[model samples]
Target: MLHPALLDRLCKTYDGRKILDDISVSLAPGSINALLGPNGAGKTTLIGCLLGLLVPDSGAVRIWGENADKLSPETRCRIGFVPQTMTGLTWFRVQELKDYLSAFRNQPDGAEDRRWADWAALDPKARISTLSGGERQRLAIVLALRFSPDLIILDEPVASLDPMARHDFIALLSETVQRRETTALISSHIISDLERICDRFLVMKKGRLIGDLSAEVFAGEIRRLAIWPDTALGLEVLADLPDGSVWVRGWRPELDARNLPVLAGDMEAYFLALTR
Candidate 1:
């Protein structure tokens, strides 16, 4: 089966520094994937390569089985992207911008765009310059989903949103993806938000793909165990375990395994454990 997106041994370098090391991954159709990494981990660079915005020094990028670099206009229209920053069109009204983008597509659904704008609580008549950061982010999302693309890539999409707005955005995203069976790759620093919707996690560190696990496996396998001095299992014993568990900071001798306290081992914890 063809993947919605695939990167094979992708490598990219800039100014004599590697921005993306040898990386390989494929996005499953209709899957909502969370791309997690710290700053300079090359999440944005990978996205750029996948979208054909940046040429990888080596390897290949394929979208729906077609070479990403040579995607036909029809294939390109099947993809939607919400960038971290929305710039250079601040003078246009929201509706005007929508119309401009719609002009490029073979089919433009103005009603669908308006529906998304309403869901985002955006005023169509409002100028882009007048929108707040969160509002601009909302507009970006609306524009990206307006055409019902098969794949959507979002970068720090909810960075400027409030907690409630973030929740709503996640819900909207989840619904849209499920309804359209659209594949989504979301890169964000907000782990909890991603945990709420993403079924798969792709962890990167220092420009390398360090981990890839389904949410279930991540929660079950990657965990923090509070070991106490009283327990027969010492740090050395844990070190000898077959699973290759490494000891992280904050060792408390007072807590024991009998009353073992297990941290939720959510995405944030797993991300920190992998990166740090």
Candidate 2:
């Protein structure tokens, strides 16, 4: 059986303000999970805490039943993390930089360069300063995956990549993770891309977990209703929708309605009931 990547009631704060509040979720081995939220929704903070870059005020983080902080260097070797920012590297050629970082993974003598080059899809002879933003981002991913870690955490990894590059990178990442049976936790606002790659999703609002749903649920359950209120009755009907799901859109209404498919219990009238 695959092990569970655990985060048990984790909480983090900065300057007396809570960033993560009792956040708890798990990623199963060989699964891809998407972390999503609006700006300032604590996605970055959560990543920092998970990577041991920031200590939480309370709670524990573990992977495959091993506490992250308690893990020794060797155990820590099984984790890979890539931040949003491209790690600045204007000093070395692409090949030189890959060779340099690959050493830390202890790959066999000549194999390091080969593996890095293959994974990055970049010419080792290319200079870092001359590489485009997409190439640099690819190198960063190569550095993260160089060790063949059991778990990969990426923050907005495709943000800088061009459309084609982003598509290619995602395909490569998906294949690599599945082939290696590696668990991945990806945080990005690109819902469309995530919908394509993620098996599960975590939604945050106001620094707290608001929704936890699988990819299917996200697509099937949540709905955007393009409503036209042509009459007073329609206005009253629109007002009847459940709280939080109701909103006025000029001459129409665009609502996020759930508990769909069934459409039971006075679908149109139920909306009027709420609006009234």
Candidate 3:
């Protein structure tokens, strides 16, 4: 209801293969949402459909109550995107690249320091081509966030980053998006990272939207229950609790719930259960 950009019954096919089949979702503004799936689950294709980059076989993707394919130039400029792989930044210095991107904007940008310059901790004077992968990715993120776009679509932006860089990127993203009230639609296979940051979860499996859960539902409705070690429990019990319930048995023998009964505190178990 919060100004949702809707994708209604989207279907796509390439060579008779349904990459996205009847996928539908509503993305709300001013929140961080995760589009999570494994390889070939159509995350990128779905993003393409949402951005109007690919024409779907049927259905519609609307942004701000208008079709995504027909968004005004102003509306287009207000959307920031960071692809899984970067290009173009390699040819210019960091500062030059920043300046180049800024010139295209018709309106004044949001706060410079808060947008990215301060926390990204990159040398603007460094040659982008010579920078390390982490540094390059950081710079790319800075560019994507520099203009304070209304909607941000990041496609596996952190998959190639190092551990420290990943942590830094997550922190930087959290700070900037929350402060600027940006709506982020992030696609990533990293469950741990997504679990830590995203307020809502949208799960796709085999080109279908299998799950949608709000942050409140995640915290209140889902639960992690443990079974006693000595007592025998089977997967049969999990079939009765909930639709997406996951049960682990004989994994850990020391915890209060040694059998790890119907754990749902994290998204990993649930996601694995659903996708498998």
Weakest 10 consecutive residues of candidate 1 by summed lDDT = 233-242
lDDT of 2 by residue, 42-62 (tens): 999888777777778889887
Q: What is the C-alpha lDDT of each candidate?
A: 0.83, 0.69, 0.76
State residue 31's C-alpha deviation in candidate 2, in Å: 0.5
Clashing pairs in 1: none
Report the number of the highest-TM-score candidate. Answer: 1
Ranking by lDDT: 1, 3, 2
Candidate 1 lDDT by residue in tens digits, 73-104:
99999999999988889999998998898899
Give each model's clash number: 0, 6, 0
Off by over 4 Å in 3: 1-4, 106-110, 113-115, 224-265
Choose the strongest candidate by lDDT.
1
Candidate 2's TM-score: 0.76
RMSD of each: 5.2, 8.1, 5.6
TM-score of each: 0.86, 0.76, 0.82
lDDT (10s digit) by residue, model 3, range 1-276? 535478999999999898998988877778889998878899999999788788999998998787988988888888888888777658788888878877887534557545477656788788888888777777777788777778899998898888887887788788767887788999988889988889899988888887788766666555445542234533222212244344432233334454444454578776776677
